[model samples]
Target: MKNILTLSLVTLSLTACVNRDNQYDYIETPQPNQVADLQDDDTDGVINARDLCVATPDESEINNEGCGIIITSSNERHLHILFSNDSADIQPIFSSQIRQMVEFLELYPETSIEIQGYASKVGNEEYNLALSKRRAEAVDRRIESMGIAADRVTVVGYGETHLEYDGDDEMSHARNRKVTASVVGYQGDIKKEWTIFSRLPK
Candidate 1:
């Protein structure tokens, strides 16, 4: 009788273990953010393979992948400001763009920017290169004055290398006298740029 009792207990323990295993299998699993569902075609969870924004930025609506594409609108695209013939003084019109970029950078923990300068084909290669470098430095100084860290900017002057126009005329030269600002590094919660996040059923 004792042997039978022991056997019965063992059987019950085995059954309990199996039940626990089954329960674990049914437990709800955590899902990634912003993935879309193709089976249901309308469900949203994490940004998945079919997600349209393949280059989906990793950030909130405001913090895109260092690209600053989230806070900026496609219709009103931000362009680099052009400098005067030999100066880096930013025109008043570029103030709004500067403000926008500054605001965006402030949200990240660490951020860096690159300023590149180009010159027209009018001057000799060496002269144009030197001029471009000065223009780039001028713009970098202006941005640094606005509270961004000086060490974070990689100032470089290509000197007419990235010219937008080919000729030495005013129109072509005008295109070459420009400074471009590019964000290089930033740290923060910047993930899931494209996806329906609200429709999840929990």
Candidate 2:
């Protein structure tokens, strides 16, 4: 009877040990869901562990990993300033247009501009090219004087290559000899004004 009791006790002890070991093995094993949590389902250059914005669109500009599209706002203005025949000087009647440009530049500090000068078909090719260049430079200087950075402005001479009016009339020539200021490359929201000729009397 004593031997039988001892045998029964030993059997019980071994069974309990086996059950405890099995419990520990179950706890240490990783599940399928846990493994998937560490994987990146969307390949947006961001891992699943730290990605705030999952499933981002491909080829979109993002400022940070997993972040949404980065947008840049800009306003483009084409301002025409007509010049007198054979001269690069800005007319005094266009002072209001210059003031408007100054106001715009002040409102949008990140804006940059390109001043393109054009001349009528009244002079030789070389003379027209130089005159156009001088007109553009004159406008560039005027803008610079209004506290805009010099580096932000680009001056170009289109000469008679891009004439607004091709006819041999006084009004056509007046329209051809002009400078065009284009504001571009700005970031964020912008308030654009009407073009110079848009407000002028016909």
lDDT of each: 0.65, 0.79
Residues 1-202, candidate 1: write the lDDT tens digits. Answer: 9999999999888677466446523566798685544342222333333444444344434222122233322212233888777766779998887777666556542666777888777758899888888877877777678788888778888886766778857987787788777664333344344466645557
Off by over 4 Å in 2: 1-74, 185-202
Q: In candidate 2, what are the lDDT values of residues 8-122, reduced to their tens digit?
A: 9998876775664465224565665554356666776667877787866655444456665545666655678999999999999987887788778887887778889999999
Q: How far does residue 143 in candidate 2 sit from its true spot (Å)?
A: 0.7
Candidate 2 colliding pairs: none
lDDT of 2: 0.79
Going through the candidates in order, what is the number of backbone clashes in each?
A: 11, 0
Highest TM-score against the true fold, candidate? 2
